[model samples]
Structure formats: structure tokens, C-alpha cells
Target chain A: MGWFRKKEKPQEVVTEKKDLWTICPSCKAHVYKDEWDKNFSVCPQCNFHDKINWKERMDILLDPGTFREINDNVSTADPLEFKDSKGSYAEKAEATKVKTGMKEAVITGRGKIHGIRVVMAVMDFRFLGGSLASGTGEKILLASEYALRHKYPYIVVSASGGARMHEGIISLMQMAKTCAGVARLKKMGIPYISILTDPTTGGVSASFATMGDINIAEPKALIGFAGRRVIEETIKQKLPDDFQTAEYVLDHGFIDQIVNRKEMKNFLYKVLRYWKAK
Target chain B: MNLDFEKNAPEIEEKIAELTKQKATDPNAKVDDQIVGLKKELDKVLKEAYAHLTPWQTVQVARHPNRPLLRDYIAGMCGEFIELHGDRCFGDDKGIIGGFATIADSHVMIIGHQKGKNLEDNVKSNFGMATPEGYRKALRLMKLAEKFKIPIITFIDTPGAYPGADAEARGQAEAIARNLTEMSQLEVPVIVVVTGEGGSGGALGIGVGDVILMLSNSVYSVISPEGCASILWRDGSKAPEAAEALKITANSLFKLGIVDEIIPEPIGGAHRDYDGTLQAVKQALLKHLNILRRVSERKLVDRRFEKYCRIGRFKHR
Candidate 1:
């Protein structure tokens, strides 16, 4: 009991460890933050794709100095007026907005890939798990509309847990709303390329993100309809190590191609290269 | 059959059942007036209790074992039903079922999630939680209906798509995702009715239509109240609070314009009187099916897209 209770240790232990290091989450290899960031946060050892913000993804994918945002002012509205035990959804959303410096989970705009103008919607997972709220849906819908009118290839990079619960049924309807927007683009023969990033599941996976003419994914992304824990609980069994990974879904034929982080832009360019503006 | 809200109705009903039994046993025993009095009392209790029900109470009613199901509606409403099976690419999924049916003057292809009445049946149907194959089966039937130029009527009644390992391995997300786009493009009228638990994406797998009808007491939501509570408050016990706030009941969705019509359930609930619930739903299907029959196919598809396209509320300023 005494041995388990307490033990005194020497005080004032000094160490010269620098704080400017980025540890690879998978391989646990230490690398300089500058070097790691220069590689777009992909682990140099294991090549694990770290979750990147919308702006980081924008910089990595879009051509330099060609990005112009649309519906930037459109933002979240508490349709349910939802207040939980912690606090009201509005306050939480506001705090997330301030924390992420994002008006909404999805930032839709016109950008370029290999000098080809395209309408791209990049979702930021930092904004409430990148839940598809009403504002997110509106922005995506507006992006598709803009793409259709301008005859630009409508591309969206989805990184969301699912639909937002604060807005309740309205969030669920966004699934249908966003899908309808994509269906409109497909009908008009606009090139719609959907990119699935690190984590895409639930309503986001079950909507526009999976209906792209050429569905693409980042390497080893967690992509599925239900969460891993939920699947384990429901089936009452241990799942395989790679249950819903991008490679797993590719094997199952859900994803068209699993592109590496460095090669993503090149892959998109190659796919959309032949489709002239029409 | 006895809901927590239906306070004294069960006791009154028991008394009536007992008195009626005595009357049946012996003609000499005059228990008619006593039975009638007890019956009137039960009716009063039921009417008072159902007048104002909490959202949690409504969810209970919607999930009641005695609540009418897809099979019950098929038996009571459809003049003829030819049950279809298999998804062509994979095995048949009993979680969802579809077939050709005639309700009133309209001939339509009907699809719906099926929950079981007992444990064995529920297990067989995976408690109405569809796996990826279930959605694929539905999409196959939907495409068949389109090819035949028949209107599609879908019944949504599930906790959600199955959240299981096998479901994920077979690509549940893409199965539902593909259905949404395909259903939207179908050149035929589509009518959807949320008969019970319209849980999230699974419900929407077959939920899109020109007219969305929800039965009274049925709950439709982005996620189940319990699921929402666990995710938001980190406490599953707060489900009642979550249910109230989510406005999952049929009335709230109707007010929100998520649902087109609210087919009234019998006093107490659909579980109380199966025929009453069946008749209301039959009437709704008949009225809308005929009206849609008159609409041009091109206009129907366009209106369906527009209906879903304008479903969100946001700040634009």
C-alpha cells in the first residue's frame, strides 16, 4: 500500500527538447515541423495523410492566385434552436467558427487545377467534425449552380463525419438537397469530380460525395457509411484492421482511384484534362 | 399495448374484457351495462391521454410492437401485391422488401423497410436496419418500376441503414448514395410515406419522392434521439431532452415543410387500431397517386429535384 501510495523524485529535472517538432502519428518518427509541413503533412516514413484544413487543402490543390470564394458570407443558422446539456448549439457553433476561422464547414469557390477553371468545395473538419449543416449544403448547392452556369468542372473535396445534429431534420434534408444539385450537374454533362479525403462518412458519404462521375480518394482515408465502433457494436465482432480504409473501399469498388497526397492534383488534372469547357 | 401515457385506460379495458367474458359465459348474467360503462371510461381515458403527448411518448407509440407495419399495410390497403425479391448482383435482403401493388385505382411499385413482430422475425429482418444489399435491392426494384413506367411508392420505417461491419464491407454508403441520384433521375412519379422510425440516411435511401407523407406519431430525424444525445451531451439518458429538441415527431416535420402531409393515426396511436391507420394511409396514397398520374413524367422528375433542392434554411446576408 505504501509503495502504491507515494514516491518522491528529484526536482528541477532539466531537458533541452525543442517544441518545433512534428511527430508522425503512425510511425512515431520525429521530423522538423517545417519539413513535415513542406511535404503537406504526409508522414515521410509511413506516408500517413494527416487531416488538413480547408485552406491547406486549397493551397495544395488549387493553382496559385486563382482561387475566388463564393457564398463566403452565407453562414450557419440554428434551425432547431437546439440547446443541449453542455450549452446551446448556436454558442458551440460560434465557438467553432472562431476557433477554425471558418464561416461554415464547407468553403465553396472557383479555383484552378492545371489552369482549368473549376468550382471546388473544400470541407474543413475542424468545423464541428465537418458536419453537413444547412449553410454547408447551401454553399455546395450554390457552387454546383455556379459550375453549371459557367460550364466549369464541379469538384468537391468531402471531409465530414456526417450531417449536423443541431439543425435536426434540416441537416438530413441537406443530403437530398446536395444530391439534387449534383444530379443537376450530371444531367447537364458538367464534369463533376468528387474527392474523398481523410475522413468521410455518414450523410456526406451517402450523398453527393459518392455520386461523382469519377469518385477519387486520398490514400488510406477512413471512408464508410457507419463508424468503426458502431459497426463493431452492431455486429458484436471485431472488425478487420482496414475495414473502411480507402484501399479497402477501392477493393470493394466504392472508390474509383486512391491517389497519393503528392499525386492528387496531377490525378485530377489528368482526369479533367480531356473535358473541354462545354 | 399499454403506453406509459395511457394512464388508467388499460385498467378500464381489463375490467371491460372481464365483464364481457362473464356475459358471454352466461346469458343470465347481465353485465352489458357495466361493460358499456367501462368501455366509455376507457375511451375517455384514451382521448384525454392522446390529446397532448410528449415527443418521447410519441416515439414509444411509433415503436410499439402492436404498431402496424409494412406487411399490415400491404394486407389492409393493397388490392393486389406480388412480392419481389433479390438485387440481381447480390442476395436478397429481408430488411427491405418491394413488389408490384395496386392501391385503389393506381398500379404502383411499392418498396419499404420491414420490421418483425417477434424476436426471431426481427432478427431475420435485422430489426429493419438495411445493409448495403437492402438498398441495392430497392434500387433494382426502382429501376424495374421505371422501366415498366409504373409509379413508385416507398414506405420508410427503419432505425437506419445497418451499422455493421458487413454492411460497410459491401459499401453501404455508396449503395444509398447511388440510390439518391438514380431515384432523382427516374422518369416516373415517386411517393414516399414515413410509416414509423424514419432514421437518417437509411430512411432517405428510399425516401425521396414528389410527395413525402408521414404518419402521425412517426419520427423522422437526422439521427435518433438517443444517438444525438450520446454524441452531443455524452449522456444517452438525455434522449428525452434530445427528442423534444430535435422535433422528430410528424407534426414538427410537417410544420418544417419536410413532410407534405400528416396522415392521422387512430386515437391513442396506430397500434390501437390497425384498420384506422391503414385507411388513412390508403386514402393518402390514393389521392396523391392519382394526382401524380395526371402529371407529365418530365415535370414529375423536375419537381422532385426542386422539392429536395429547396429543403434547407440558412442565412444569406
Candidate 2:
């Protein structure tokens, strides 16, 4: 004797599929994809900055045709012979390369941002959630070394889930390795500006992401060392709505500032200009 | 309910316990012979079990609740220890304890991760999971050690860094990163010992050193065996198999040149003989310190950097 009852079926109406309209995760507003792109993937309704891939990030941040990539050929080898339920790490690497069209998760290069030449390393979260593999660490070190050698401002836009688990302890060593590179750059007095984008957590956040002299985050960017779910479960408490968000980090002083995607360029130029003047 | 190793020696343990209990209950009962015989049998069982322990079994022993924690080791080894608290950037984290201490007539800054002795202490210490504040506090102490030219000694024993949202918010990664960055070039000798579980970046937070020591029974890896098992097989029960494949035991790490020395534990485990283990660690520390202190400060820093730089190596062929 169940109280639940089957209800009458209503007539179905089919509407034309609209690929252009996408819903904002935060605001739940239907926004045109083109409009979102024009606004740098930041939802106009609620200013929720959507995660951007490295190529898109580069195009927006770097001057057109002025970017020169460094350490572009370094890719990860299946050092540990790691295999998982999905497949081997090598197979995943190949698949991720095809999907993301990049050899590694991080793209290290020298580029002009608002006429201020800087060495930049932009991470693509699409590739293995931007897990810092040995190659990623090598690339970051190379970028920092390049910045030090050329005396350019070093910038790294982080959007990673943290260390590459498949690579095992070899992946964990990157945290120390990259930090060592940053230490050298700092000792040489090179400016490092860490830009935290949406979904930067894990080993990536724990290491170089937070070591920036001038740490910046995009509006509503998710930046933290651990995942939200991991934290909530461990603490046995419900978290605040804004926890681990850019606004929350800014309030806590972990980051220097939170810039909207549109005005971030101007803010970088202003900071660069101040340093230049000094 | 029992340790994996204990379960392996259940018959011997039961006999020993029963005999010991009988002696305690009946004053006139001559159970000394039975207790001694059972103890001998238990020893033999322990030896056999430990000698042939699977990686998962080793993991269990490494995380045994009765294992002597950082506090016990510090109390036993260091003389005139004064605890310094707080990161100064945030509140003090009890997960990591550090202070000025004297060891073998040399003043050193000793730091380690403390997994509390009992349930209440464990809860309070976040089960040895360090937060950003803990790493920050460690960095503060390391910097202080550099200022006074005190040798840095860190006893590592954490599952990993705290993976909580608030910890991440406060910059757990950055804190660990900064420690790695700053400690690399500190103008003082840094010695690291893996007294227990050395899980991933949490251990590496203070891991960069002139000499890295690990207990024979300890295991270190990027991810825990259970974590690896879940990811690799979608089954946590596959941890035993995953542990075998991860090659995280002290012997494996030593063979891979990831660890400089392996401090042999007591016959059963460190937990069974705290004083013996402490004395052995102290001796190992003195031996390493005597050699490390002879190296010039610049050379020490260079070697430390070089040591980490050469950790992972493989041939294309």
C-alpha cells in the first residue's frame, strides 16, 4: 500500500536545439556563449569567471603574435609505468594531448602583456586537471630561469587540481623543485606575479601558486590547496557559500587582489608601470 | 580490531595475554614459565611476520596507534628543549611542534609532526595532518634557525598536509612551497628523518635536507596505498596489491636513492621499544650531524639543492 501514485502524462513539445545558449553555474542564467566569450567567459549576470583553457587565456592576456613559447617540447614519460582503471598514464597522456592540443598541462613562454614584456607560464586545467607532472615542474623552472636570465617579470596563471598522482612521488617532488626555482628567481630579485584562476587547488596551490610576490585572482576564482569536498568531510561542518572563492581569499589576505577578467589587463599594466617607475 | 601484524600472530599473542592475565589474577599461580615460553613464541612469530610483511601490512605498522610520536622522540632525544609556537601569520598549529633544542652538545632547531598518543590528542592534532599554519610555523622556525646558524633537524611523521578547505584558503600549498623554497638555501645544515608515515608533499614540506633518514618500518609515497588502490582499481580493498606496486617501503626508497639512510627499528616495531628506537635515532642523528657540520654552509646549501635535483632519474632506453 504505497501512497505514491502515477500521474497523467503531458504532451511533449520539441524545440530547436540551441548550442549558443549556456547556463551560468552560479547565477543559473541562460547566457549566449558568444557573449560569454566576448566578456572573457565571465558571466555578466553574476560575474562568475568560467574556467578558460591555456590557449584562450594566452590570446586574451598576451599581445597578438608577440608570444614566444619556451620549453614547448618537454612532455611526461610514463616513469612509474602507472596504470589505473581508465588506462595507462601513457594512453591518458596521448588522449589528453589530442583533446587539449598541448604536449603538457603547462605552457611556458615569454610574451608581451600590455607592452610590458614578461615570462608567463599558463596552466590548462583541461589536461589532467592541470596536475603538475615532472614536465610541468620542468617547464615552470625553465620559465623562472628564463625570467631571471632576461630580468623580466615572471607570471604564472594557475588553474590546476594539484600534483599528478599517476606519476607518484616523482610528481610530489615537483612542489619542491618549482619552489626551488622560485627561490632562485627571488634571490635574483625577479618579480613573480601568481595569478590564480578558477579551480586552483591541491599541490599546485600548495607550492608555487601561493608563492607569488603579488598574488592575484580572477573574480570568484576557486583557489585553495585542498578540494572543497575533502575539507567539508574532514571538518564535519557545512562550509560557507563563499568558502575558497577568490572574494573569500582576498578578504583573508592570502592573495593581494581580485581583478575582474576584463580589467585584469589594466591592473597588470598598472602594477608593471609602478615597478617600471620605481 | 587488531594490528595487521598482531592478527598474523594471534595464537602467540593470545597465549601470552592469557598467561600474563593468569599471573596477574592469581598470586599463588606459577605462570612465569608459561608467560616466558609464550613471550618467546610471540617473539618468533613477530620476527617471522615482520620479515615477510606485505606493503599493506607495513602501512598498518607505520600507522599503529601505539607508535612513539614526535613528542616522545623529542623528549627522549633533545635536551633543554624550549617550544616556540605560532606561524605569526595565523594561529599556532599544534600539528607541527618545533623549538630550540640541544642534541649531542650542538644547539639545533628541532621540528616534527606530532600524531597524538591517544584518541583525544589525535583529534586535537588533526591526526597529524598539518594545516597551512603548521607549515608556516615550520618555515618561521627554519628561518629563525638560519638567522642563528642553528642546524635544522626535522622528524617527519604525517599522513600528509591538511586537506581541508580552510587550510587551503589559508594557503597550505604556499606555506609548504615557501618552506621548500626558503629551506633550500638556508645557510644551515638541515637533517630530515622520516620517523613514521611520510605521505607526499606534507613530508616534503620540510624534507629538503643534507641528509634524509627513514625508519626501516616507515613507508613514504606520493599517495597512500588506499588512495592509489581506489584510483587504480576503484576498490580500496586492493590496497595490499597497490602497496606492492607503489614501492614505498624504506628499502625501496633507499634503493632508489630517495633516502640517505635507514634507521633500523626494534625487533617488533618502534612502538614496542620506544627508548631503544629513540636512542638509535639519536645515534643516527649524531653520526650524520658530525659529517654534515663539517661541510661549509655554502657547500651544504649546494649539496641540498643538488640532492633534490637528482631525486628522479630514468633512462629513455
Question: In terms of docking quality, how is candidate 2 classified?
Answer: acceptable
**Pairs in clash, predicted candidate 1:** none
Model 2 stretches with alpha carbons more than 4 Å out:
A1-33, A276-278, B5-43, B163-169, B228-233, B312-317
Which stretches of candidate 1 lie above 4 Å from their native place? Answer: A1-19, A276-278
Each candidate structure's TM-score, on Cα atoms with residue i matched to residue i, is: 0.95, 0.89
Cα-based lDDT at residue A28, candidate 1? 96
What is the number of residue pairs that collide in model 1? 0
Instruction: Write one digit per residue (lDDT tens) for candidate 2, span A156-211.
Output: 99999888887777788788878888888888888999999988887888788989
Task: Go through the candidates in order and give each one's DockQ.
Answer: 0.64, 0.37
User: Could you list the iRMS of every candidate?
Assistant: 1.1, 2.3
Residues B265-315 of candidate 1 have per-residue lDDT tens digits of 887778879999999999988899889989998999888888877778554
